[model samples]
Target: MAKLFPFLQIHDFLSDKLSKEILDYAEARQADFSPSTTSSGGGMAMVTNQRISMTLKDLAEFGPAIRENILAIAPGIIEQLKISPFEIGEIELQLAAHGDGALFVTHIDTGVHEKSEKPRIISLVYYMHTQPKKFSGGHLRMHTLPIGEDDVQPVDITPDHNSLIAFPSFAPHEVLPVVAPNVAFKDWRFAVNCWIHRA
Candidate 1:
């Protein structure tokens, strides 16, 4: 293990061929995600303008490229957790847009549902924004605290277009607010969030 809490930036992790195929499939399979607006209207509020989401099974028609990436990334993430023989139960794509300061605030993505088999051991997020660089803000921030230390350190990750980020699910993290809006801001932020489990 390189570090107990580290953020990885794997650029161009998805091949062009696969990325193109997945994009096409995502286009056809994409569905508008309901507003997950938070009570607060600043750093972490989910926009009400536009959001999209798709389940792994729904995206299966897109071909093996998507599933292949999921399969490959999940196990590798587990290896980092020092856990072996684990499985991924469910995967989801979270697409958001800048609708009046919409952004995800600081919070841990632990299992939301009661008694979820997944338990969110690890979380894998893939950036699908065509122009990830042009967009302002929306950075994924990771926070870490030593076992007994009260002070927490933060790391910022803004992987280039088509990059992927994997880390422990228990880690406290949040998506920083998008400071400015762009022409592409009308559509979803375009990122896949997957939850992992023990095999």
Candidate 2:
């Protein structure tokens, strides 16, 4: 099915205190982060040096403010999905970061269980960085139309920190790797991944 990609720049999505709190938590626990590669049999080197900061079931553990923002915004996204409330499920947050040479291969997000009432109806991504130019090459691309056929090409979403990006989770999307010469100040490409699922 054809999908529409929409991005919302919610000013101050996270309060300053909350942002600092999360950043500190992530930095302290950054080393605990391990390489996450695709099922395509690629190693840490396959994509690049990076880490998955958190998992789906651990959203509440992040903090109060972060969780509050999520709670406030997630429902709207769910509403846009046109899916039943009971069909949606808990959201997930992952702190994605890249070092000097990091990359994420192109792939599609898997929906919820096949027999569920909601299933996976939508996908969400929040850009935590303020200055996206700090790191180059990590362009967010979405293919609304099937490749090899004439279409809108693809929606290009640069990591403009504090930008909230949401779209159909099942749509084909990818990260074009951080090919920039130098990594930005924080040197971390932080993002939050949220989804609407079948209840």
Candidate 3:
């Protein structure tokens, strides 16, 4: 767990116009988002008090595009992360938004409790928010191996708009608290969570 892992980050993953369009689309579906949940390592998902955020299971306008791009670049991502190549399985996509006082504690993407048809291999998060961003904080902190609340080495990312990042699913990471003041959900920190699975 102490091994130094590799991560991929690309800026300007989409055009400004497209980024704005995605944000608008998300804002329009505020009602569709529900409280994010965590797995109990058994076979069931549980509502937790640790992570605070909202998520939408689908994003019709751009889900396909994101999937296509991820699939196209996944091999490079895995090679960069020094993982063995596997046939891509389902790509799980979830739209997430975090407003004031929201944060997700450190956790890995691999199932903490159970197994699946296709285990997650890589995790990608595409950040999107209004220009002249209305939110503060919400930084993504990827912990270097051997991490803990007391002693740890971490890399903090700003979650720049239209930027995308990828990392191994087993790496531990967390989102810092967000401060959006009085802005609406549309102005909150937005991200598309994608999981590349092994077939």
Best by lDDT: 3
Worst 10 residues of 1 by lDDT: 49-58
RMSD of 3: 3.3
lDDT for each residue of candidate 3 in 57-124, tens digit (9 for 90 to 100): 87996888889888888878889989898888888888999999989998989852134566888999
lDDT tens digits by residue: candidate 2, 1-199: 3444544445566666666666566566665665654433222224333322222223346644554576677778656755445544545445666554565556666644334434556667766653435566666787675444444556777766666777767677777666546654355676666665655
Clashes by residue pair, model 3: 41-113
How many pairs collide in each candidate, listed in order?
A: 7, 2, 1
Candidate 3 worst ten-residue window by lDDT? 111-120
Model 3 error, position 98 (Å): 0.5
lDDT of 1 by residue, 27-81 (tens): 5554543445442222454544332222333445443455567677666656765
Q: Kindly indicate the candidate among 1 and 3 with the higher lDDT.
A: 3
Model 2: residue 153 alpha-carbon error in angstroms: 2.4
- Candidate 2 differs from the real structure by a C-alpha RMSD in angstroms, to one decimal, of 5.2
Residue 5 accuracy (lDDT) in model 1? 62
